[model samples]
Target chain A: MLKISGINASYGKIQVLKNVSLEVEEGSIVTILGANGAGKTTTMKSISGLLKPNSGKIEFLGEDVTGLRPDQLLRKGVALVPEGRQILAGMTVLENLEMGAYHRKDHDIASDLNKMMERFPILKEREKQLGGTLSGGQQQMLAIARAIMSKPKLLLLDEPSMGLAPLVVADIFKIIKEINESGTTVLLVEQNARQALKVSHSGYVLETGKIVAEGKSDELLNDSRIIEAYLGRKSS
Target chain B: MLIEQLINGLTLGSIYAIVALGFTLVFGVLGIINMAHGEIFMFGAFIGVMITSTLNAPLWVAFAGAIIITAIMGYMLERFALRPLRHKQGVSHLAPLISTIGVSILLENLSHHLFGAGNHPFRASFAEISFQIGSITVYLVQIVIFVISIVLMITLSFWLGKTKAGKALRATAENLETASLLGVDTKRTITMTVIIASAMGGIAGILVGMAFNSVTPQMGLSMGLKGLAIIILGGMGSVRGAMAGGLILGLAETFIVVYGDSGYRDAIAFLAIIIILLIRPQGLFGQKIST
Candidate 1:
C-alpha cells in the first residue's frame, strides 16, 4: 500500500502540485485521471523521488520515503515506467532488460529474465538488437517489461498508451490488467478515462493539482458530471 | 623505413587511443568535457616519476601507483569540483566546464610547485635494450608500451561489453533518470566512470613517459589537445571512434614528421581534423547530439 498526504511540489518558482493527496491499497489498480497539466506526471515523479516535494509526506508500506533518491525508492520495490517510455536507446534489448535488475543480487534474476522473454516474445526475438531501433509499440512493451523486471511491489505507470495506435492501446491495457491480476499494485496515470476506468478498481479525477472526485471505477464512470466532462454523452 | 615509422606510429597511436578513450568515457556518461582530465594524466606521470626515483620501485609499481593515485584524484574531482555545480540554475552546464578548467589549472600549478617546472627523466633500465628485425629496430620499451596499451584497450572493451557494472554504466549514459529508476545508483556509477577514465589517463601518461624518456608538468596540455582532436575526428563518445581516430592521428603525425617539416606536425594533424570535421561534423562514428 502507498499513501501520499497533502504533498506540494513545484518546478522552481512555479508550483505544479498544491496539497495533492491519494492512496492505493494492496493488490489493486488505482488510476489518477486528468487532462494535460493536471499534475498527474508530477505526482508520479514525486512518489518515485525524481522530484523532491516542497512539503507534506509520501509513505510506502508504513515508512516515510519523502525525498529519497530514485534509486533508493527502486530498492524498496517502487518502479516507475515514466512518460515517453524512456528506454535506453543505444543499449541492446537484452542489455536494457538486464539493467532492469541492476540492484538485485538474488538468483531469481536469470529466471525472471527468462519469464520476461516469454511474456514479451518480440523482445526475445530482438534480444541483440539495439533498443532505439525498436518500433514505438515495441519500445512501450520493452519499457513495461523493464519496469516489471525489478520485481516491484508497486508499479507507477505514466501515460503508457499515449501516442500509440488504438489496437496497441487496447493490447497495453490488457497487459496492464494481466499485470494487476498477477498481484502487483499499480498506480496508473492516464488521460484515457474509459479504458483506465475499465481496468482500475478505484479512480480519482485530478484537476489542476487537486483531486476533484474519488470513488469506485463503475460509479465514477456513470457519474453525471464525470460522464459529461470525461466520457461524453452515452449513446442509448 | 616506412615499416619502422608505422611501428612507431602504432606505439604513439596506442597512447593517444588510451587518453582519448578516457575523454570519451567521461563525456559519454556525464555529458561534461572534463578539462581536468589532462591534468590527471600529468599528475600520473609525476607520480610515476616519484615512485621510480624516490621509492626506487620497479616500472610496474610506478604504473600501479599512478593509476591508483590518479583514480582517487578523479573521484575527488567529480565529488568536489564538478558535482557541486550540477544543480545550479541556468549555468549548470557552463559551471562544470569552467570549474574543471579551474581544477586543471590548480592541478598543473600545484604539481609545478611540488615537482618544479622541468622535464623529469624516467630512467627505465630496459630503455637501452633493442632487437633488430630486418631494417626496423624494436626497442623493449616500445614493445612493452604497445603490448600493455593493446591489452588495456581489449580489457576495457570486454569489461564494458560483459560486466554488470558496465551495463549499469551504459544505462546511465543512455538515460540517467531511467537507470536510477531501475535501481542503479547513478551517482556511484558516475564516480566509477571518472575513476576508470582517470586510471586510463594515468596508464597513458606512464607509457608516454617511458617512450619519450621524460615527464613534465605541462606535458598533458599538448597530449590532451591531441586527445580532443582525436575524439572529434573519430566521433565523440564512440569507443571505436577514439581507437580509430587515435591511430589515424598517430600515423598522420608520424608520416608528417618523417617526410615533412617536423615542426608542422601538430598544426598539420589538427588541420586534417578540421578538414574532416568540415566534411562530416559528427566525426567518423558520432551520432548527432540528441537534445
Candidate 2:
C-alpha cells in the first residue's frame, strides 16, 4: 500500500498540488479524476518522485520515500508512465521496453520481456520499429507496457486515456484491469470519470490541487449527483 | 603526387572528425553547445606538448596524459559550470551555452598565461620518420594520427550502440524525463558524457598538433568553429554525421589548399555547411525533428 499525506508540490512560485492526500491499496486500481490543471499530473509526478513534494510524506509500504529522485523510486518498485507518452522517438519499441526493466538485476528479464510481448501483441510486431512512428493508441499501450517492464510493485499512470479514441480508451482500461488482476497495484489519473470509475475499485475526485470527493467507485458512479457536484461540468 | 595529397587530406580529415565527435557526444546528451569543447581540444595539444617537450615523455605517454587530464577537465566543467546552471529555476535555455562560452574564455586566457599564446613545436620522436608506399611518402606522425583517430571513432561508435551505458545515454538524449522514470541516473550519464567527450577532444588536439608540429592557445577558436560547422553539416546531434561532415570538410579544405590556396582554407567548412543546409537543412545524418 502507498499512503500520501497532505503533500504540497509546486513548480517554482506556482503551487500545483496544495495539501493533496490519497491512498492506494495493494493490487487495486485507484483512479484520480480531474480536469486540466487540477493537479492530477502533479500528484502523479509527486508520487513517482519526478517532483518532490514541498511538504507532507509519501510512504510506500510504510517507508518514507518523499524527496527521493525518480530513479530511486523505480528501484523501490514504483514505476510511472508519465503523461504525453514521452516514448523515446529515435529508439525501437523493444528498446523502450528494455529501458523499463533497467533497474532490475534479475536474470529472468528475457522471460518477462516475452510476457510483455504476449500481453501487448501489437508491440511485438512493432518491436523493431521506432516508438515515434507508432499511432497514439499504440504509443499509449507501449508506454504502459514499458512501465510494466520494470516489474514495479506500484504503477502510476498519468492521463492514460487523454487524446485516445473512446474504443482505445476502453481497451486501455481493460488492460489496466488485467494488470491489476495479475497483482501490480495501479494509481491511475484520468479525465474519463465514467470509464475510470467503471474499472477502478475506488476513486477520488481532484479539483484545484485538493481532494474534493473520495469513495467506493460504485457509490460515486451510482450517485450521479455526487459525481456531478464534485466533477462539475466536465464529468459525462 | 595526387595520391600523396589525398592521403594528407584524409589525415587532416581524421583530426577534424575526432574533434567533431566530442561536440556530437555532448550535444547528443545535454542538448547544449559547449563552447569550452574547443579549448579542451587546444589544452589537449598543449598537454601533449608539455608532456613531450617539458617532461621529455614518450609520444604514447603524452597521448595518455592528455586524455586523462582533458577527461578530468570535462568532469569539472560539467560538474561546476553546466550542472548548476541546469537546475537553477527559470533559467533561460541559453544559460548553459553561455556558461560554456565563459568557460571557453577562461580556458583560452589560462592557456595563454601558461603557454604564452605562442605556438609550441611538437616534439614527437616519429616526426622525422616516413615510408614510401609506391611513389608516395607518408610520415610516421600522419599515420599515428590517422590510425588513432580511426580506431577511436570505431571504438566510440561501438560503445554508443552496443553498451548499456551507451543505451542509457541515447535514452537520455531521446528524452531525459522518461530515461530517469525508467531508472537511468541521468545526472551521472550527463557527467560521464562530458568526460568521454572532453577526453576525445583533448586527444584530438594531440593528434592534430602532432600532425602540424605546433600547439597554440588560440588554436581552439578556428578548430571549434570548424567543429560547429561540422556539427551543423553533419546534423546537430548525430555522431555519424559529425564524423562524415568532418571528413567532408577536411577533404574539401585539403583539396582547396593543395589545388587552390591556403588563404581560402578556413572559409571552406562554413561554405560547405551553408550549401548543405540550403540543400538539406537537417545536415547529412541528422534526423528531421519538427520544431
Candidate number achieving the greatest TM-score relative to the actual structure: 1
- Give the top-scoring candidate (DockQ): 1
Which stretches of candidate 1 lie above 4 Å from their native place?
Answer: A234-236, B288-291
Runs of candidate 2 exceeding 4 Å displacement: A226-236, B289-291
lDDT of 1 by residue, A105-131 (tens): 999999999999999999999999888
Q: What do the candidate models score in CA lDDT, each in turn?
A: 0.91, 0.90
Q: Compared with the true structure, what per-residue lDDT tens digits does model 1 show for residues B77-128?
A: 9999978777666765678888989999999999999999988998787889
TM-score of candidate 2 versus the correct structure, residues matched by position: 0.96
Clashing pairs in 2: none
Clashing pairs in 1: none
lDDT of 2 at A12: 93
User: Pairing residues by index, what is the TM-score of model 1?
Assistant: 0.97
- Per-residue lDDT of B78-197 in model 2, one digit per residue for the tens? 999999988678899999999999999999999999989777999898799999888889998888888999999999988877778888999988788889999999999999999999
